[model samples]
Target: MKEDTPPPSSPPPLPVFKMPRVHKQEYWSFVRLVAPSTEMPPGQTAWKTTDAELAYCLKCKTTFKYRSGSSASIRKHMNHEHPHELGSVGREAAVKRMKNALASKRKSSAVIFSPTKRTKKINPAEEEMATRALIEWIAKCLRPLSIVEDEELRFFITLVQTMHGIYELPSRRTITERMQAHAQQLRSLLKEKNAEEVDFYSLTTDMWTSRTTDSYIALTIHFMTDFFELRSYTLEVASFCGKHTEVRIRRKLRDLMYTWG
Candidate 1:
């Protein structure tokens, strides 16, 4: 009775593709997760600055690269290549979610933005006044000039003041120039007052070395005005590199006196 052949075996079942489960914002339903090894060509390693993952489109089987936690590139691919599948309603919803997510992130980072509010226009005069006031405050308080670039101060101003959109902070160079102008104005005023009101003047000098071993000498002049009001002004602060000899000090004072005259 001959060899009875076994029944023809059925072919193996096709692999079932499972869609990856990810954050709702990632919109993973339209794509399949791909293993990096399988996604890359043989003998080539996947290189990325961020933690990268592969995305395979369910509809087109196209591969896209994206950061591990975000499917923004995949979403972009879908919007560009398969817009018909992602209907107008779906596209709008996706855009809205993206915007809301970005706004949330900025808020968490201490930045506030108002999209619908109409901001008041700041006039040039107002802008100039604010800048002058800021400069004066920085000078009078001996605060660092870099404070104008502080992020927290910027956020605070943006959150509270409506003109933050139009008002730019003065740069370090601008501040330095303004400070020089203010110094010159004050010096001119002092010279005029001294010429009009003073009979005699007394002067004092001090020299010291700072922690960094740099030496400095300060000269201050004192006098009584016509109204008996006493005033003092620091006329010079010279950086001295050599030994602080008495002769050098007298020469420096004499040079300063001649310059002032």
Candidate 2:
């Protein structure tokens, strides 16, 4: 036979391709209160009413201030105080009205800032401080300004918000809820620990009405600790409604004791 055929050549090895790895960038996601969509949904326009940007609370029958003068404020108040009212005559309709008013300013053609992936997380300490500030404003200072719209308060809050990246301030409703919640928490703590520390405690009770005719009854307890340190602490501050008589007062005191007992 003639020369053997050329040595069989190995086929070319298959080329291997590697998949590219995708690096995901995480951004702090939140629902932005932008100008509402182009139209208002049904039954939303009536929520547009505001007195100095404060919405009227149907439950309280009073105008309460909110930061943004937007429907979100009324909606929030409804959610916390009147959880029963939502979806039926919802504030979405009113919010749509407000957003529509502001639509001209928030143009799609306006210079848009690109979103950054490196978002600053809200500081809890700063938020708590803000909450305390809100309580001071309403309770101590007697200022019922909206958290967003108050000129003087915003100056102070803006400093904290910008410095701490806490864009959201405490809602007025949040302030009310937190005040009650914190009070309840302290009351529970005192109930659990007071008996363990004192053998006996004497109580003092008093009732008074302010210029606004809001009645208040305060109770205090005085006691000596095991270490012989004298201590006087407030036991309760309750609203005294209706007539104040010996029979009624005694019954109320008994009810109060039953509450903490």
Candidate 3:
């Protein structure tokens, strides 16, 4: 009995099993990687004419076939005809996709080879010098192109080159065009901010006489918080009555206050 008890036999060893090896493809299949489209809805084509029998552009009044031509042409038609119906992001994405596709196709098919030599390491000082020189040149060109003010343009270009490491600046024309576009965007943003009674708080006034003996009137808005910290915007011309009469100035101030409120 004791001998049998002694052999009360060790419990069977737990079975060891190997986990199934997951292939990269199988793993990726389970992962949702594609970012949600902010431009257009899925299963829907942008700028495609509605179910109406006749495709008429409300903007340009031009008629075209449904889903015909390039997306750009379609978007252009919509912009000219149905500008109000098109969303901003949708139009932008369509134009960008078209431009990118065209550019990618036109790009030279030459094979680019990275330098094999270790001696071609980038020198930080040289890179910085090159970046600064390029930034200055960009600033000078931006003013005449009416893109942005010299200082602001320089700052922006410098920031882009320094932060993003875009060593090769685009053509001057392209830079100017882009800057002009961004300036327009800035103006639109300013308009939106002005439209919304956001952070506006106080008023700044300045009076000056022009060459034509006209008393030019200028006023600025000051925005402040409960912390008494002054905000950054310069004085914006609130009124230009041509004469700085007290009554006119007061009326203009009142109107501005009303609008701001």
Candidate 4:
């Protein structure tokens, strides 16, 4: 009997290549896009119809055509024909250009604004208004509370203070505490207003068990205002410790109602 032989391994996949941005001077130095042509010059081979775009090498007489406007064929040609030249000019040149551009940008931005030395004291009311506005903006935009500590944001605020009265930006902890306190105050006021204006309310509930076998319940109340407008508010979402029996659930509902009232 003949011994079995394993099949030959497949070649590794080719690397994906993307066309460099128009402003990338380093890449444009060796590659340039040209109008597509069916005819290759006298000595060249015939072109395929599948070619969507054409690019010619700047350093040599070779031209490449690729499907779907891909730059991979052009890049492969460079890798094979101009490996040493490409290595000396590609990644290193791009990185150096980016660094120089960023340094120039920083220099230009620095000269745009000059912070004034004369600092005026901001009043308590003005400071409170500014803090509330900042909080509101953060909440409305769904921004992380730690955005207060961002250097760019702080710089912009400093620029504003150069003309207006100076005020300190709140810390993350301060914003968190204020949000919690405001939420509690709003809940209290809602309960008080509901008691005064609503005669009866319809309650909706959802119960679920977590992956860890822990159960939780959510209670929501729907009521009509004196003006006949319907409104709904979520009362609580609490964890249930014991068995979720009817009696236990009833007791929990009663306790939640009492707490809200």
- Per-residue C-alpha lDDT of model 3 across residues 1-261, encoded as one tens digit per residue: 554522212321222111123222211121111112334446765323222222333233334432322234444555554443344444465656655654453352233535562224358999999868767876876635444457666545544533435466799999999988876665555556655644556667676766776665555666754587666454344436555678888887777556434
- Residues forming the 10-long window of minimal summed lDDT in candidate 2: 22-31
* Residue runs of model 4 more than 4 Å from their true location after superposition: 1-176, 210-214
Quote each prediction's TM-score.
0.37, 0.38, 0.30, 0.33
- Per-residue lDDT tens digits for candidate 2, residues 1-261, read 696533213211221111123121011011112222344558665222221233333244434444443445545656676553343233444545545544543443264646662434469999799878878878777766564576666545434533436566699999899999878766766776675576688988999998999898888888987788889878888999888989989988888888878
* RMSD values, in order shown: 26.1, 25.5, 21.2, 22.1
lDDT of 3 at 166: 48
Question: TM-score order of candidates, best first?
Answer: 2, 1, 4, 3
Q: Order the candidates by lDDT, highest first — what do you get?
A: 4, 1, 2, 3
lDDT of 2: 0.56
Kindly report which residue pairs in candidate 1 clash with one another.
none
Off by over 4 Å in 1: 1-167
Per-residue lDDT tens digits for candidate 4, residues 45-158, read: 534333336555557745565555455665677778887566556657865865566566556555645466333458999999999999999999999999999977875654
Residue 162's C-alpha lDDT in candidate 4? 41
- Residue 234 shift from truth in candidate 1, angstroms: 1.3
**Candidate 3 error regions (>4 Å):** 1-150, 156-188, 191-200, 212-214, 225-228, 232-235, 238-242, 257-261
lDDT of each: 0.66, 0.56, 0.47, 0.67
